[model samples]
Target: MSVTAAEVLIDTLHDWGVDRIFGMPGDGINGIMEALRFRQDRIQFIQVRHEEAAAFMACAHAKYTGQLGVCLATSGPGGLHLLNGLYDAKLDGQPVLAITGMPFHDLIGTKTQQDVELDKVFMDVAVYNERVMGAAHIENIAHLACRTALSYRGVAHITFPVDLQDSEVSKPTTKRNVPNHTSDVFAIEAGFPSNRDLDLAAAVLNGGEKVVILAGRGALGASEELELLAERLGAPIVKALLGKGSVPDDSPYTTGTIGLLGTKPSQEVLEECDTLLIAGSSFPYIEFLPKPGQARGVQIDMDPMRIGLRYPIEVGLVGQCRKTLNALLPMVQQKEDRSFLEKTQKGMKVWWALMEARGTNQSTPMKPQVVAWELGKQLRNSAIVSSDSGTIATWWARQVPAKADQLHSVSGNLASMANGLPYAMAAQLAYPDRQCVAFVGDGGFSMLMAELATCVKYQLPVKVIIIKNNTLGMIKWEQMVFLGNPEYGCELHPINFALFAEACGAKGLTIDDPQHCAATLQEAFETPGPVIIEALVDPFEPPMPPKVTLDQAAKFAHSLAKGEPNRDKIALTVLSDKVRELI
Candidate 1:
């Protein structure tokens, strides 16, 4: 049977195993939408309010399911609106395909009403960008875009001209097929020396009295193997922020996350370890890594470039971490020494106990540490939480413990602000049965506040809890630490978030006192559909269970003694333990 370009487009997606396409229909893509009606059961279409939200949801779907998420849009302004979310997908390294409609071929450069070069605009963000000029090029170009996105695990764009999509094919076309199986061709081409490197890495871990294994999100599917290796070698595992709870937090080998916002136990333990093994973690900050000369380091990663990208690696293995670890397990001997492991565990226990003690006290500004702890208790095993990059992120990293089957989705590598709302939108779309909550700061929420309308329109039941501190708390802390005073940028104007939520047709709640915060959160969670709970916390309130610091304490004293106080008169002395111990 002769086929139209629109029919072939949907058919190609079905062949590629795309189960869902999140988008709204428009004039240019009406033909494609009509073609999708026949196969509604096999590939469902999720209609969203705006193209931006659709793209965000598509990106989240890919992250959760590890599939190539799909989104569609009309030409010009419609395609332009999708850029923010596409940028988010590209930065997060999620595999996605954005199919955009274009103006007629005859009017290519004649400056039509909505004419814009979508391919060139998207080139910088996506890994691959192409325009299907004719029906002859559709089959090959479509397959290439899909395969490139899947192989590279990044965004790919394909634009179809409106006239071309509606035109009938003159000649017969063959259906395109992409090979399902992926090979380790990257490793082979890179010429990674296997036998000798494995032997050397095995020897170093075996010989060292103290060894640490740090993993990241790249190690998602290999959590079990990681735990087994850690247990066998008596080496505890430290996770990157994204890798939190990759293994059950209660597991014996699980220490915590390592970074600037890292827990005291993780920082202290990593600092003391003599040998470090980095498995699939491409953490950006080199300072958080063990000093190059001090620790004997070995890195195992799927991407060859990431192996030695940041910290210097004594040995680099370019393969999946699980595969490389499987090969090395038999070559290495199990260590019987539990001295270092036991010591690290003891330190973690002590830190947790101290945090718990300090967090329980009732105070104004509602300690994020305590609030996050309470929220963690309320969290179900299936709850998926996403946090923005700020003081709120620090609270989530330190206080909220990880549970099995639970995932914390975030826009990493980019460290992008205003990601919490979009992430929650995607998580809700991906896992409809499970509860998805976004812990957003007021500043971060303001970035993409319009998404609330998207949530209401789709009836996605995502709970958004605003940590309303009325200031940019993280930047304020940075000012106190570096410039020796609070800066003008740290101040924030009060927002009526509950009223805003009401205007968007979503349930809303506001809590002023610390005592009512937990119950308010509980009510928000239980409310019918999409709900936003704004906890009006103290703007000048101290950070929850402040970090152990001597420099902070000295700065506090100097500011207090100044005739004209250089800093906010907030009592940070409550964070200090003993005078000499913290430094």
Candidate 2:
């Protein structure tokens, strides 16, 4: 009997070294789902509750492993649910392949049920988007999608009609697999910048007196080279959020994250630097970057389009991050004056002191900063931490100290909520032996709370720490800063997250008192199965920016006058802390 196209597609995926796929079964995808069942030993199918979680899991899998992550969904709404997670993959530059099953080819355009245009929907997010029209095209299309996703480091999508999936084909024509199991169609090499471009970049670095290095996700592979570059240039390094683990937070020359979710020391470094060296990061926030004419910049990126995109660049060197940095290091002159680096390091120490004071607060409703600080301290060097976006991100970015060997991931460019749980689930699935933890806010976690069952079903043993403030903490802060409005519609009715976890067959604990915060977290970490620690944090504790501008103060004051809850307590404590610095 001739093999079906669906079987051939699965075979191609297996040949390309794909171990697992995340998705749900549906009528539209029954053929492919059955094929997956038949090939259970070769490839595992992780059934998620929602298609969104499936895509999120796949995106996280790609991010954690640096390989092509695959996800599947049925037609119409199922495929639509994948947009947000697929967008996350696209923006973060992760290689992910999304396979969606569409309606029968004949009924696609007849206003049939579940007949959405998959190609049109996925075109923007995918580097390669195609629909398999014939049975023979399955292997070729599958191979191309995988290759495109891996080589380009972005999303590739293939939509298969349900009827065509089971269509039989004889002797599918494709390239022969080599002895090493790599396909001839997918072999590629890394590209680097020209020698002239490297020399120019080195010259720019050597000529500047106050140099600051901005590292991004692209620098993850070149930690040693990055350290050497910073040492030689006497430069202070400020990491972008995605670059959290690119360098150890304990490094003398390293300042914390720089942006809205950044530290004062990093902001200071950005303000004072005369020359900026950006490696492997295209952080989109221009407001956080130096103004025009503030600094001469040299950007190192593999994509020429992203170089000098956020800042004005004097030199843009297009090359692989590790290779480019290695080449530039030898040509660059070592700085004689280490004053700037020393000053930044001193400022970093003061910032750490301030954070320590905040993290140890003994307020009635526990401060969220303490959770991040305690968790960071307790995390092993081999631990993998996934943080959700919003107010929770501020704590992780500021308080959590990431080591070189440890891994950290957040929703970077997309900055979407509800990713923490899925990210943690995928990380745990990928590295079952490693300690995995997720820091998620109440609002964000509620968005995908159903996935808790996904964790328990697999017995992933992922530790979930929910900062339950019963409010959209980040949005409330934003309203105060931008609209001068008392937070409206941001409040959430408190739910017993601990009880919810227990209902899902997981151990749950609640830490409302500051005294037991540390002990409770330690217990949760030690639990053998999936655990959820619901820390009822103080909602009034705002995620203040590194520098509070005059306009921000005015808006905050207006918000207070408009009867923001806990105004007196928040103003007296947080505002007073800011005022003491002025004195």
Candidate 3:
């Protein structure tokens, strides 16, 4: 049988170390599907309900595994569905490849049926994007796409015309006109920073009495060294959401996550610190960081572009972070004064205590924090967790204790909804033995609820927890706090998610009563197959900030006065939660 271009493309991907792909099939991409079927033993094909979920799975697979994640979709609408998830990968800097089918070559640009110009569509999301001209073009572009995706730490897209996909042609090579990256898979290794730059960073870190370290996704795999650095400098670490695994919450050094989904200790430390050492985090929100020139800054990043972009740094060290930290440890001086560390640790104690109280309290409608806190309390230390965006994200950030062995991530830069379940599914596939949990809001989960079938079919055994507040809780709060507007168009019609899960041939559990919350979560997590735990939580409970600004307070009050829905309930819930901390 003559070899097709699609087969050749799959072969190249196999050679590049791709083990599996996530996507659904369509008529436009039947050629690629046949190729995947032909070599089913070599590569696993994970079928999903939506192209968007497939893209999310791929992006998250890359994030959790550090491998090139690939998603396949058909042309036109299928291709269009991939943009949101692809954007998540691009913004969060995950290495992903999105392959889509296009209309026949002759039919393209005629505005023929399903003739969406995919090349133009992918321009913004991909670091490397190209369409295969013919069979001969497959091997070269496949190699280039995977290489570029890994190198840039971003998205790559390849569109193949349906007609040329099944055509037979000889491989083209050794021609001068052929592009340069035609060789086998090659690695671009990162080196350590120069001795001078390391010394400069160490000097700034050691000179300050009140120093704080901020770690992001790039700082993974340096837990021990980072802790040592923290001890040496008496600094507490504020982890960005993606880097939650960088340091253990069990350690005295961690102040939890930053930004709105952040801790009071992190807020206080950033506000009062005299020197800052940022590692691998371009944690936006400069307002939350130390004021410029109020503190000396040092940064460590592999990407030179990200090092000094978020903050003004006196010293920027670019290199492999673990190697960089090891080299600089010797140069840094240990501080005998542990006053700052003591104070930070004290604040963390109170924060945890407050979180525990909220988790244990019995409410008419379950509190969102109770769901996250109960889940975290029961999950295995090695378990992985994915948090979807919203007030649920806030609860997850505050209540979940990120152990060093646990992996946690969300749509970091993009902050997109519906990523939690997809990310958890990817995690379950990656670590079949270890449990994976998706802490998702009702609004986010409803957006991609069909993927529950993906979990059942694949037998992924992921534990999905839905905080069912029946509202777009985050947007309602944002409208109140940021715009001083009454909540409008934020409510969602309730769905019985537990019943939906049962209908999908998976285990389902419901916990509307706080009294049985822990037992229900334990039952859901302990079930053998895929399970969804739907907890009906209070929509009125606010995601209270660590520090409320006068402007924010004014805006929130104005919103309530302007007849925000359930304003009295909102005020009482907010006040009670805040008051719990002092007690």
Candidate 4:
């Protein structure tokens, strides 16, 4: 007697330390799902309404736990739906394994039902892509894909053909051999930064009138080292949104985030700095970048390819930031440019104060920041907060302080909308003892609202805060920025989210008054099961605080200040004092 391929795969997943999988069932994947059902106690298969939501859930699980997240999909469209969220995981360098269904090997070339090339569609976004053609290839391919996903720290795909899924295969008693990457292209000296690279970077810093530091997603892993580097150099640090909390905004060297939606200081520092040390981020906006040829740009990245991708580099050092920065710190000389760093830090402080002090008690519609900040204060230190892609995500990342025990997970690289609720459910389920909440926009909430049933069924305590503005806030803002007047098609109809949550077997509440936000949140948190609190937020809510580019403001004014245009009709005038003062 021989074990089936599906059973062997599930047993292997259990051995790989996977406690659960998020996926949807389909005819193509019936065999695999059935296998998963047999081990419901050892490895649970969490069925989600949409494959997109399932992928997002796996991403959150990986981010919170620092492990590989797994999601399954049926053939054709079901497999395709996983790409958007899987792309997010890949860009962020998260370890995610997407097991997708495909037509049997024989029918692949014939273009049978859902017979698209799954591996080909996924190759661009994943670290590795492989299809199991024969039962003999299962054990080796599965282990290889897993190792590749972990090694590259990104998404990997292993397509299981329907024909091969039920076929019997012998399981290896020991873990199979996994491939290793030994690229000389990325190799670095064993000791530290070469004397030459340090000499060049140090000379630039010593000679420059002002020095600034720009950190990106790559900086996430070496946050403490970055802080030390900033402190030693007395350079102001501005993180990309993805690099939120790389260092406390209050740190002496901190200067908030930089980009189109970035703070005034971040914009000003790039303009003023004679030397800019780029750390761990390939920030894409070329217009926001400083003069690469004349201005000194020193980059530190583990992947050599990313060093000079976005901007011209004066010194490109390939190594882990933590290790390389530690080695470079001693060899480099300190700068005495406290004036620039001081000015930038002071600007950030005043910006935050003005933003927070405004309309803490407005009578009309409540400020969005006020709601987010107040919720921030009420959240326990151990709570984990997830934000969907939108203005709300930016607000939470900026205003909500993540303490030692607290974790803040955002879809950075993929930066897609509607990930909040899915991430919230997964985070809460992963750490049931800790509180979990998702701050989502009206548009984002609806994207994954169907997952409410999954949360309720599992008895996972999670809270969802929906800013019901009834329109795509960020897109509306973009229209105001790029296009001259207000645009059509951005507006959306309002949803009775409270009714929807109740229908899904979870507690739901609606709050129109700003005064009751804290209390409403408290009651929701106290509820034993999942809860959704929909706040009919002001349509005229201010944009996320800090990091508004001068060009964006200028473009907006150029379009609107001419007259009370029709575009302004759709715009909400209930601006937050916090936002106005900061910009």
Expressed as tens digits, the lDDT of each residue in 1-583 for candidate 4 is 6877787778777777789899999977877898898889989888899999999998888888877799999999999999888988987777899998988778897968988898999979888788876666666666666767766777988888887888887644344523222221311222345778877876765666677778876666666778777776778888887676566555667766776556777888888777788887877777777876657778888777787888778888777677777777775566655777788778878767754664355545666766787777788877888888877875675566545456777788667998998898889878989999998998887877788898888888888888888888888777777664554567888899999999999998987777887788788878888888888776766574245558766767765665424435434452334345556
Model 3 residue pairs with clashes: none
Q: lDDT per model, in order?
A: 0.76, 0.90, 0.90, 0.77
Instruction: Estimate, for each residue in 417-505, the C-alpha lDDT of model 2 and write its tens digit.
Output: 99999999999999999999989999999999999999999999999999998899899899988789888889999889999999999
Per-model TM-score, in order, reads: 0.88, 0.96, 0.97, 0.89
The TM-score that candidate 1 achieves is: 0.88
Please, what are the lDDT tens digits per residue for candidate 1 over residues 5-101? 7777777777877888878787767667777887788788877667876787777788778888999888898888788778878866778999887
Tell me the lDDT of model 4 at 382: 79
CA RMSD, predictions in order: 4.2, 2.5, 1.6, 4.1
Q: Tell me model 1's lDDT, rounded to 2 decimals.
A: 0.76
